[model samples]
Target: MSSSTELTEKKVFLLKSLDGVIFEVEESVAVQLEVIRELIEGDCARPFISLYNVTSEILALVIEYCKHHAETCSGGTSATIADEDLKTFDNEFMNVDENILLELCSAADYLDIKSLFELTCRTLASLIKDRTIIEVRKMFNVENDFSVVEEKAVRKEFAWAFK
Candidate 1:
C-alpha cells in the first residue's frame, strides 16, 4: 500500500521521554534502532515513540552521545588527527563519576547501542575490580535495603573477598 519513495525519504520522528520532554530526531538515526525502525517502516499513521523509562537527564545524555557518534561517523573530525588522540578523546569522554557512569550505562542499554553499553559495562567493571562491596554499594547509592541479618549473611559469604 506504500510507495518505495516514501520509505526512502527522510521522515521526522517524535520521541517522548519519561519526564515529558519530546525530542525530534531524523528518521535515519531513529531507524538505526531496530524496534523504532520497524515501527516507522510500518503503516501506522501516528507513530509516537514513547520512552517511558528514561528520565529527561538521561535522555539528554543519550542524545548527546548519539549526536557525538553521528558527527564522528559523518567525518566531522579532522582526518589528520592521530589514533592516539582519538583514543585519548574517547577516554576523556567516558571518564565520569560512578553514578553518572551507571546512568550512562542504563541510557546506552535503553538506546540499544551495544558498543556503548559494552564500553560502559567494562568501565564499571574496571572501577569495581579493586573495590570492596561496601565501596561498590556506596558508589552506586545502592541502599542496604536488606535486613540486618541478610546483610550480615551476604557480607559473611563474601568475607574472604572483603578481607
Candidate 2:
C-alpha cells in the first residue's frame, strides 16, 4: 500500500439526504457514522448511501460535525491543542436554532453517531435545566396537554422539581 497518497486523494462516499441532496464525504468523515462503519466492515457499504430519515440541512450539519472531529483528531497537533480546538468547535456548532438543533440530534441518533448525539443532548439538557416548565415546553414546541389547574397541581406536587 502506498502511504504517499495525499488526503485529497482519499476515497469518498456519497450520502443522499431525504430531500434528495447528495453530499460527498471522505472515508474518514463517513466512518464517523457508526451505521456506515458497520456496513463498511461487512463489505456492504455502497459507494453511495441513502438516508431517508435525514433532511439535507440536518445531514449537512451532521457531516460537518463528523468532518471537523475527524480532521481535528487526526491532525498534526498536540492532544491538548486538538482537544481544546474540538471543544471550542463543538460549543459553536451547537448554537443553531432550536428546531435545527433538535433535527440534528435526531439525525445524529439515526446515523448512530454517538458523539454528536451526546453533544446535542447535553446542550439541550443544559438549556432545559435552567428554564421554567413553560419555557422548556416552548423551546421544544411541545403543545401543552395539561390544563392550567392540572399543571399547577402537578407542580405543587413536585415543587422541588419546579424549583
Candidate 3:
C-alpha cells in the first residue's frame, strides 16, 4: 500500500533521450537521476528534460532500474521483473555484452545515477580484475601503443602492478 505522500505526489515527468525517444517517469523515479533532480526540484521539468548525452536504449534501462529501486526501497513490492530480488535483477541487468556494459556505464555517469554508476563500474572491474595486461588489451581490442623501451620503463616504474 502506498503512503498518502506517495499517492499525492503523482507528478510525472517526461525525459527525452538523444535518440528523440521520450519516456514518462514518475516523481519517485525522476529524483533518482541526479542530473535531472535539480530540474525537478526547481519545477523546471514541467517541460520534458532533454538528455543530450544518453541514448534511448540506455535511458530506458536507467528508468527501469530507478523504478525498481524506488519500489523496493520504499517497502513496496514490485511485481515487475518476476519480482526478482534486486541482486538477481542487478546481475541479470549487467549481463549485456561488454560493449553494451561500457555504454551503460558511460550513460550512468552522464546521468549521475550513483547506484547505477557504481554497479556498472563494479561489474566492469570484476571483468578486468586479475587479468594480464595483454589479456586486458585483447579483451578491449586495444593495440599496444607503447614502443618496447617505453613499455619496459613504464613496467619497471610500476613493477608491483606487473607482479
Candidate 4:
C-alpha cells in the first residue's frame, strides 16, 4: 500500500469545536462518528474537523474523556490500578453540579462517545430519579417556567409520587 494510504489507515482526527477548542483523538474513536469517518476515509481534505454546534467548554470535556480512554487503550498505564482509584477519579470528574453534568451529556452525545454519553445520562437519571420534584428543579436550575395553573396540572399528573 502507498504511504498515504498507510498513513490514512493509521491516522486519526482531531476535531475542533466552533469556539476553537481542539481535541486529539484516535481514528478508532473518531470512527465512532460514522459520518465524519466516512468523509475522512473518502479523502476529504479538511485539515481540521469543525464541530459548529458544540461549545468549547463541552468539547474540552469530551477531549478529556477521549484522551483518557485513548491512553488506557494505548497501555500507558498498567491495568493493575485498584478499582477504588478508578471510582475515585470518576467521582471527582463528575463532582460538578447538575448543569455542568447536563452540558457534558450533550457534548458526549454530540461527540458520539457512546460510553461517556451513557454514563452521564445514567448519572443524571439516577440523581433525579429518587428526588422530589422541588429537589430536581433546584438541582437542574430549571426555573418554574410553567404558569401557576400549568404547575398545578403537572403536580396533579404526578400526584401518586406525592402520596
Candidate 5:
C-alpha cells in the first residue's frame, strides 16, 4: 500500500565512535548490530548513535564487516552466491594483528554483532590453542597473577592433559 517514493527512500544513520569520529552507514548495515538494531527500532527518528567504548579504529572495522554482511545478504541475485566465497571473505576479514583482533573482538561484543563476536573470539582462541600459559600471557600482555607454588600445583593437577 506504500507509494514508490516511500519504498525508494534510503535510511542512513550517523554513528559516533569513542574518538569523536562519525560514520554514515546504511540502515541495512546498522541493523546487523543487535545493539544498534534495538536502538533504531526503539526510535527510528533518532539521528545519531554513539558508541562510547568503541575506538574509532575498531568501530571502522566493525562498520566495514557489517556493511559487507548486509550487502552479501541483501536478498537478490547476490544472495545466491557460493558459500565458499563467504568463507573466503571471512578468512580475509580476520587477517589482522593481535591488537587489532582484540580491539575488534571488544567492539563486536559491545555492538552485539553475534557473528562477528563469535568469529573474533574463535580467531583469538585459535591463536592460543596448545600454547603455554606463559606464551598466552606474553601474547596478551597479561600479568602472571598466580604465585609459583599455585602455578605449579595447577600444572601438576593437569599434567595428564598437558601430554
Candidate 6:
C-alpha cells in the first residue's frame, strides 16, 4: 500500500488478439467491453485477456473506439468531445469496406461492446436498405455459394419482403 507501489500498479490491462497481437489498454478503455469488465470485477482478469475470436485489425479498431469513449465519458474530455462529436466519430468509424465491417461486427459481438455492435449492425442494415437482393449481394461481395435452384427457392420464399 505504499504510494510508490500504488503508482506502479497502473490502471491498465492487456489483451491478446487472435493473431497473437498483444495490446496494452487502460482499464477505462478495457471496461468498455462488458466481457472485460466482468472479468475485472470477478477478479479473474489476467495479465492478458486472450480474444481468440477477434483479429488484430478488428481488435485495433475496437480499442480505438473504447479509448475514445473511455476518455469522453470520464468527464476529462467532455468539454472538448461532446456526444454529437462521438456520433460523428461512430459514423466515420463504420465507413470501412464490407469485409472489415463484418469483422468489426463479429468482434464487437464477441467482446460484448454494445455500442460498437449496434453501430456495425446499423451500418450493415443501411447498406442493404432500399437495395435489391442482387445489389445487396454485390455490395457485400457475397458470392452465390448456393446452387442455382436453391438460390431461386430461398429468394422466392422471401420474395414479398424483397419487393
lDDT of 6 by residue, 14-100 (tens): 899999999999888888888778888786877689999998888999999989887677665555556877888888888898889
- Of 4 and 5, which scores higher on TM-score? 5
Whichever of 1 and 4 has more lDDT, that candidate is: 4
lDDT of 4 by residue, 37-156 (tens): 667788672687888878888777666665565556565555666344455656677877688899888777766777677779988998888798789888777777999999889989
**Residue-wise C-alpha lDDT for candidate 5, range 1-163, written one tens digit per residue:** 9999999988889999999999999889888888878788877536688889998888888988888777677646454473555667889999999989998998889889999999999999998898987899988998998999998999999799888
In candidate 2, the residue pairs with backbone N, CA or C atoms under 3 Å apart (3 or more residues apart, or in different chains) clash, namely none
* Model 3 TM: 0.81
The per-model lDDT (C-alpha) reads 0.72, 0.88, 0.89, 0.73, 0.85, 0.85
> Residue pairs in steric clash, candidate 1?
none
lDDT order of candidates, best first? 3, 2, 5, 6, 4, 1
Candidate 5 has which clashing residue pairs, if any?
none
Among residues 3 or more apart in sequence or in different chains, the pairs in candidate 6 whose N, CA or C atoms overlap within 3 Å are none
Candidate 6 local accuracy as lDDT? 0.85
Q: Which stretches of candidate 2 lie over 4 Å from their true place?
A: 1-8, 160-163
RMSD of each: 5.2, 2.5, 4.8, 4.5, 2.4, 3.4
lDDT of 3 by residue, 46-149 (tens): 67999999889888888889998887777655566444678887998899888888888998899899989999999999999989889889877899999999
> Lowest summed-lDDT stretch of 10 residues in model 5?
75-84
| Candidate 3 deviant stretches above 4 angstroms | 1-9, 77-84, 138-143, 157-163
lDDT for 131 in candidate 6 is 86
Leading candidate by TM-score: 5
Report the lDDT tens digits of candidate 2 across residue range 108-144: 8889999999999999888787787678888788899
Stretches > 4 Å off in candidate 6: 1-9, 76-81, 138-163
Model 1: ten consecutive residues of lowest lDDT = 79-88
Q: How many steric clashes between backbone atoms does each model show?
A: 0, 0, 0, 0, 0, 0
